[model samples]
Target: MEKTLSVQGMSCGHCKMSVEGALKDLDGVSAAEVNLEAGSVDVTYDSEKVTVDAMIDAIEEQGYEVS
Candidate 1:
């Protein structure tokens, strides 16, 4: 499944990389795309392996806020 999350505190390419990297590191996530300009993240993940809350927490762990 795919999920789009609104995220804050991403100001540059590095921030985007960090957020994307964190999400992609999760077990169920197959892909993550972070758009710093859009302040959002698009993630493709397996629902059976992970939950939305977990995905949110993973992004938050990288020092960002997701809504």
Candidate 2:
């Protein structure tokens, strides 16, 4: 499934890359598109393998906030 998460504290390409890498490294995630200009992340993941909350945690782990 796909979901768009609102993110905060992203100021440049590095933040975008960091968040993208974290999500993409996960087992269930198929894709993670970080739109720095829009402050959002479009994620395609398998729910059976990962959870939305886990995705949020992954983003937070990268030092960003997901709302």
CA lDDT of every candidate: 0.92, 0.95
Report the CA-based lDDT of candidate 2 relative to the real structure: 0.95
Question: Which residue pairs in candidate 1 collide?
Answer: none
For residues 10-41, write the lDDT of model 1, one tens digit per residue. 99989998989988888999999988789999
Give the alpha carbon lDDT tens digit for every residue of 13-40 in model 2: 9998999999999999999998888999
What's the lDDT for candidate 1? Answer: 0.92
Give the distance in Å from residue 43's predicted Cα in candidate 2 to where it truly belongs. 0.2
**Candidate RMSDs in order:** 0.7, 0.6
- Give the distance in Å from residue 22's predicted Cα in candidate 2 to where it truly belongs: 0.2
Off by over 4 Å in 1: none
TM-score of 1: 0.94
